[model samples]
Target: MASDMPNWFAILQAQSYSAGGTVPLQCETSATYIAKVIRKVQNQGYAFISPSHEATADFNDVVSRFFDDKVLSESCNSWVKMGPGRSRNLVWWPGTAHRMEISRDPRWEDFVFGRAKETRVNRVAYFGNGWTERERVGGVESITNYLKEAGKGDLATLHEAWNE
Candidate 1:
């Protein structure tokens, strides 16, 4: 079980792909798998836990480019919430949303024989990140109730139909 994150990730990816836009979630959120792992590799220069499947290659490829890119490796520490000394132009605090992109192409000439481009920090903004646990568990029921109370039954009906 300790070494199963990647495998779980592979299964989750497959499930998500099969199930369409909605993530295949149970108790924990999908962020625990995708976002956390990507953030970890971006900061540490390697995957915290590599997936045993071929999917590992995709995740590794992106992080490896980060290690090779000077800008990212040098500024990786500031993205986390440990302190205020992080890079001035970029930041991704803990328990909140964040994103980054590596522009290096491993299959191209510059990746191996030519000069590599600098990495750019991307910080994405997400809403409702600090909701309480009780609020989360009752999300669907509460939202449905709220919609009904607010005379938005049509929207709730549309949502239920879309989910089906």
Candidate 2:
């Protein structure tokens, strides 16, 4: 079966839209599909996997612009806009947390575009943080539980208190 990540992402995005907020996910965390594929193409000799040259270039450009946008306050470790009526700076990094945006941090390039030395690829691609299996799995379960309960509780109370 195909991975459920995409469906999970769609559900989260839909919730954000309904609540008048941006998706409550870090860009790198949620967009790991490309990163995983890139890693596979490099490590597994998946020559059939190819992103058009133009598409790759455009993605790099977009990353550059995201870092350049001061208003958005993006960085290698930054929270995106969360649910409506919630602090835009709030995020879940193992738990409720906040990060300071480091303007044009060089690590952002490495985090987003660098490959490990062992990889076959001689080019930059998506590289997110190193997450242990327990952290990744537990985090997802935690969020799912929170969403299920909060969705029920918030609707009952007619207020959004999920982030509280």
Candidate 3:
């Protein structure tokens, strides 16, 4: 729903963050938000990487409105390929105590973006929706339960995205 593109706020809001922000307020609002949340996921023993569908669509629209594909293809870096067939529902890196790891490094961003990293395939874990996987694990429900046990189940953080 935002017309802004590529800016940090645009990126966040585009990714379905429903915080208190309008066009002018988005920058400051988003900055404050990022400050609070950065590296917070590491405390939970994992990092979250979800699609910014709105942002992506807005970016393409901007490109068409202001420029052309040649400029875009040349200036923009290659996008990470993410999907069910190529990758899994989740990409996980191990953390201390044999849990998931969340890093703030560029490589971590690449992984979050779902960029190809064949070498890490053996080192990292990918969970899909296979029957065997379901039998072995309880999917998101299990993870939510684990978070509650770990004292990381504060619903406020999740709900804070929506601007009341």
Q: What overall lDDT goes with each candidate model? A: 0.34, 0.36, 0.34
Determine which window of 10 residues in candidate 2 has minimal summed lDDT: 95-104
User: What's the CA RMSD of model 2 in angstroms?
Assistant: 17.6
Higher-scoring candidate on TM-score, 1 or 2: 1
- The stretch of ten residues in a row with the least summed lDDT in candidate 1 is 107-116
Instruction: Supply the global lDDT for candidate 2.
Output: 0.36
RMSD per candidate (Å) reads 19.1, 17.6, 17.7
> Which of the numbered candidates is closest to the native, going by highest TM-score?
1
Please give the TM-score that candidate 3 achieves against the real structure.
0.21
User: How much is the lDDT of residue 141 in candidate 1?
Assistant: 63
Model 3 accuracy (lDDT, Cα)? 0.34
- Candidate 1 off by > 4 Å: 1-52, 71-147, 151-164
Q: What is the TM-score of each candidate against the true structure?
A: 0.24, 0.20, 0.21
Deviating ranges (above 4 Å) for candidate 2: 1-47, 71-164
Q: After superposition, how far is residue 131 of candidate 3 from its true place, in Å?
A: 34
After the best TM-score superposition of candidate 3, give how far the Cα of residue 66 lies from its true spot, in angstroms. 13
- The whole-model C-alpha lDDT of candidate 1 against the native structure comes to 0.34
**Displacement of the residue 84 alpha carbon in candidate 2, Å:** 36
lDDT of 3 by residue, 5-53 (tens): 2123232332222223344444444454444344433322333333256
> Between candidates 1 and 3, which one is better according to TM-score?
1
The per-residue C-alpha lDDT of model 3 at residue 117 equals: 47
